[model samples]
Target: MNKFIKLAAAAAVAMSTGTAAWAADYNLTISSWTGPNHGINALMWPGLIEMIEEATDGKVTAEVKLGLAPPPAQMDLVMDGAADMTIIFHGYQPGRFVGTKLIELPGYEGNAEAASVAYWRVYEEHLAALDEHRGVKVMGLSTHGPGQIHSNKEVTSIADLDGLKTRLPGGVASDIGRELGMIGIQVPAPKVYETLASDAADAVAMPYEGRVGFKLTEVAENVYEMPGGFYRGSFAFLMSQETFDSLPEDLQKALDEKVFGEPASRMLGQAWDEIDRIGREATVEAESNTITIASEQDQMLYGQYADLITKQVLAELNAAGIDAEAAYEMVKAEMAAQ
Candidate 1:
């Protein structure tokens, strides 16, 4: 009788352990602008995935699907549930992103790491509860890197841009060119290299990352460093409301713990900083090119130009009945506080 009772107890314990193990399995799908072959895929994406998997004790594993479509298609794909989640830039959407403009304030930031984490925190504390983001669950909101201009022509001063046709996607790049005296053309990003190489445009205004992705150095050599990332744009990772709602509660909790809450800023910032570095390297390695960058004096003038555009932004913000003064003040105060 004692032996039979011991056997029964062991069987009950094994069955309970099996049941717990069965409850642990979770699966997810993810995608991003950086195609599967990019370093960002090799580095940041996998690192984030590993963090989630480990945090959930291997209960959750992600299958990352990259390069499924162009950048413009990302937001739509997530919304339609064609993708589980993705990273998207609002600049691609134009006037549709009016509410998120508070983040794009010029020269208004602290340490990007803390600023980014704070951005997510603030958005959740304030913006997330609103109807604006009801269709998607935002993982984070951040503008990742400082930017500079790489062009075929030297932009030593604002005058150098006169009549120079440049490739700019939209938002502040178009606004800055107009503010500073250049004639700008709005074109799809994939066509930028073709435009410049074929002489449709004399230059392009973009952050350094594209230099590597598009092999930018072969066609453009002169680089103008516009620090504080004047033209840098914001991006966010998001999940479809329906997809998120469909997840099992425990799996959803695992995601919140893994991707939400807070991640070391290093995980996010490193990918952005790498783009700038790689962009510069591509320019440097290009054959027979003179890089005429902005000096501190030139940068000072650029600062004034940046400020002037801020006024323009404020004007536009006010016309739409958005009182950006306090938010603007908060941004400046945060930058100063840093």
Candidate 2:
């Protein structure tokens, strides 16, 4: 009986050691600025965490924490190691990201998923030279659905966009705002509802998802949608290089194969598209809100501006030695194939 007890104790010790080792091979923390119910927090992060845990065979996992920092500060937070991972809207940091504008330019005629997947392909093939994301590891690149105008007042024609105090998410949205003669107020997505409610901005340019995610329908009450939209917003899912490098080699390989790059981008983009549909439905169901499709003439006028924006972006990219025109063509072709 004593011999049997000794063997059992050894077995228990071995099992305990194995369990402790497996419990947290890597514990990553994700910082998010958006509200808890935001689709990114509610849907995308959960799915991504599941993918990571599954791919790493439960040896790696992530947790989401809110209010670690504001949206604009998230990149710095991750870079400084205050957080292991976070997402940033490229537009929020004006001069910091140029290659990302390639995906934000208007006239890309596809859902966010296709555009995002194409964006990743274009980045890997051509725009990687820009090295815009120099400090952190870029896990995924994505664009929000096409952007529209949400306002307290009705906006039926392109002319109506002029002189409105509009909240534009920097980057290409600023260019589009200038072309439309809008007075630009720069704010992050989470601040949008308060900005509108306080009358700090009379209109906001965002994807349909913002209608619900930011609670715009409660405050704005009107949506003016141009075909394709004014411009899409670019975003980056970033991980700290230090944190990533600290992981076991096998876990890194698992993430690269199962969770990063194109797969992650595709997942995020699909979530955006799905949330956009939900936001639209919610807006339509709200009796106070009205949706207006831009007239054909108005769309054509916007299209002309889009062409100019495209040229300007390409020129900027070329000056940066990016072979912008070819990159643009590649994005279009890849989007088409998708």
Candidate 3:
């Protein structure tokens, strides 16, 4: 049988034997969709695995396997036990997620670290009842750095963005696109480089890390940055319920109390903040790339746009029986305190 089956069989037999002091070792498989060089692969996964190993006293660890499935299919992959763990971008699945949008709303004043910690707290306090991640065990919740407009087309003002064909990851970003008069093109994150390079899209809404992660620095050379960004992307570090349940009680408790939840969320968020900084540096160092900070007038205009989207999204959540407005307030407060 395969290594997973062999290990699982051993675990099952040990558990059945009721060896109270047995220390079972587990190697979890983490499915990832991004390129091998992306920070999620090169940095986040390794760091998380280290946290897991440390917390479990080396009894549990994980390795990331890329391209097991596409971005949208990650959650289902974990549910089906094809992968033990993975990260899913909530927006990629569209209507499948509602409470998750709490973290994606724009105008939250903080970097990804603060946002992620706040996300975890807010999720526990208010969103846990949503049970949106039904089958999988949620290991952590995080948001990437604020997403800005990256384009080959010049964007010096909000008005300049009108009529631009832009790639938008659905969520508040799509609402923002509609308000800004952008013609939205939907594509997975990995396809961004080719889409822009081939002139299929004039611009993309992504965090700064896309500069290096998706080669946006080479294709979408101009960055029209708003102070708080157009939106943040929501991501969940998820594990199969089967995989989590299969672990020894001690190992599970260690992971739950020490490595998972807020701790993992903070780590992932901080990593995004660091990668965003690196992406900013890459942009400055690139020959043709330019960053145009939104003018005061443009920032004001975008704020109005953000307000409208925020109201509509919260109303949708409220209709679905979530106290989204209260959760929204908590998110903002938590982020600020962080």
* Winner by lDDT: 3
- Residues 139-173 of candidate 2: C-alpha lDDT, one tens digit per residue: 99999899999999888889999999999999999
- Candidate 1 residue-wise lDDT, 1-338, digit = tens: 34224333433332232332445565556766653334345445555666766667777655567567788788788888788777776767788665465566557555455455555554554444434555787766665555456677766766677778887666776678777777787675666777888878888877676676555676777767765655656667777778778867886787777665456334565556655565566567666655566678877887898888888877766665556565566545544553
As a whole number from 0 to 100, the lDDT of residue 134 in candidate 2 is: 85
* Residue runs of model 3 more than 4 Å from their true location after superposition: 1-24
Please report how far candidate 1 places residue 118 from its true position, in Å: 4.1
Q: Sort all candidates by lDDT, best to worst.
A: 3, 2, 1
TM-score of each: 0.80, 0.93, 0.92
Between candidates 1 and 3, the lDDT winner? 3
Global lDDT of model 1? 0.63
Off by over 4 Å in 2: 1-22
Error of 2 at 318 (Å): 0.7
- Please report how far candidate 3 places residue 35 from its true position, in Å: 0.6
Clashing pairs in 2: none
lDDT of each: 0.63, 0.87, 0.88
Give every collision pair in model 1: none
